[model samples]
Target: MLAIVLSAPVVLSDLYARRVPNAWLAATLLTAVAATLLQRLLGATPVVWPSLPGLVTGLVTMLPFYAIRWMGAGDVKFLATLGFLLGVRALLPIWIIGCLMTGVHAVCMLLFRLPRIAYAPGVSTVRQHLHASPLWQRSLHARQGRVGLPHAAYLGIAAIVTVLTPDLMHWEGA
Candidate 1:
């Protein structure tokens, strides 16, 4: 359930502007709340609430890119939501995997010279430029032509890794 919510934004964003839709975010948040409640009803012990930390970490890490116009607001929001849904224990591995996936995607894009597209700094900036720009614009104004790997895909991959290796987050100090 969490995985589904987390992955939806990535998939949707990839098809569009690598931006997570508001509907998706709303749905994910609702689902996460319900799931958490359900888990509690089922007698699952809560370790630590991870969503807040995950959101903070994601925002901090992605801020630079957002500032430089490298990523969209939706992407940042999606990552933070993913962190909240996954919680701290599971989120670490997911973050690791997501980063790895992003790196791989970046390398591939660089090699392929794929055009990258992103929203300019302000809403007004984007609005001002939209009329004058091509339908598909790169997010960054780089010499190699804008091309970037969809982070959502990597985020999904990371979620899968964490789900499969749930024990990885458990620490038993010997």
Candidate 2:
């Protein structure tokens, strides 16, 4: 619940700017820590400080994807922050859900633009078709491929949803 509520702004920001501001992330972290301290002082169950393994897990998991340019640096940092706030166990499930969501979005976009799809079973046939198209059409095709994925928005949403789902991954608490 805390994770979900706190990350709401992040989701909105990512959706808007395709970027996660460092200041907001840091402030959220600080606020979470302060809230946990207050909870402890009140003799409530203290929010578990996310473990070292969780932090490392987040970094190790996203680093390769970032290296390949599949996702931006903001997404990597967002995942790492999520790991710190949630736990190591939540990272992969959230990531998987986010990826599946992105895949679904891509499929829907493709379906919506069905006319743009050109199916070719063979590589030679693909080249032949490409060459057959006018230069203007080819340029138009290239430009259409530049849609931004805005992975951080997807990922932040996934993380929030994952936390909201009851007993997801059998988590006792974060």
Candidate 3:
């Protein structure tokens, strides 16, 4: 889907630096907007649609986490922007799926005692480099504990899976 294609970088950035760059989000917004307009011009439902209620829903759903300082502002904004693009129908399922995945990740961390790579105590995120990241991902890093989960990564994964498999939350009918 177009949303998946556009959201990839934001997800990678979140995984890399525990951050979602505004540039990438802005790019996504612009692209979606352009695509929506074009789709309308063609007299069809926009594939890259936007939803005001979804935008609000995303912010409302995630704001509590941000207020607790458990989630970064980037994560919240990323979700909100994605909500705007993917619409309300998809956002809730994405959120539920992301939370479940994060729970699994936490359990794995506890079970395996995942090692955390330490860094200088006062290193800035802007100056940090992804030295340990793979050759293809020599692009991002930050001070992160192994126990902490980057919600954006999980949410991005959820969004992709939800879009690809829309019946994920409709199993009740089965």
Candidate 4:
């Protein structure tokens, strides 16, 4: 519930602004630590260690993709934050399911846009296909084109769903 609540703004920001606010990410990290300590103090049953290793693993897992421009740095940081909150066991499943969801989201986007894009001329390459069409140009002042998946939003959704669904990812309180 905490993870989901924290991620809502992230998902909204990514959807509208194409960027996740750093403040939100920082808040998430602090909240994860504070939540863990509070849960412990409250004697929450089935408490799991907030795994720093899991956070590192999550960052490392996404670094190459960020380096290759397949994923954003913000998305990587977001996943690491989620890993810290979720612990290693839940983080693994969340990452896997998020990846799958991102793929599905990409395919659906492509399929939905295919008809609108098919008639555009000189769009022969993969890069051109992924970018804005000559037929429908954006203003110069508009933000730069987006490539690949908005994986942060997808990951946020995945994390929320994983945390909410029984037998998906085990939450400490669950």
| Candidate 1 clashing pairs, residues 3+ apart or interchain | 50-88, 51-84, 115-146, 116-138, 116-139, 116-146, 116-147, 117-138, 117-139, 118-139
> Could you tell which candidate, 3 or 4, scores higher by TM-score?
3
Residue-wise lDDT of candidate 2 within 107-166, one digit each (tens)?
866764554453424644665776787863655464344436767778888888888784
**Winner on TM-score (1 vs 3):** 3
Better of 1 and 3 by lDDT: 3
TM-score of 3: 0.72
> Could you say which candidate leads in TM-score?
3
For residues 48-88, write the lDDT of model 1, one tens digit per residue: 44477776776677778778977766667766777777665
All candidates' lDDT scores? 0.65, 0.74, 0.74, 0.74
Q: Give candidate 4 regions above 4 Å deviation.
A: 37-49, 112-148, 170-174
The local distance difference test score of model 1 is 0.65
Report the Cα lDDT for candidate 3. 0.74
Show the lowest summed lDDT stretch of 10 residues, model 1.
Answer: 138-147
lDDT of 3 by residue, 69-173 (tens): 888888798888879887877887888888898889778656544333233333333224434436424432253432257788889888888878978745542
What range of 10 consecutive residues in model 4 has the weakest lDDT sum?
Answer: 134-143
- Poorly placed runs, candidate 1 (over 4 Å): 12-17, 35-50, 113-147, 171-174
Q: lDDT score, residue 158, model 3?
A: 89
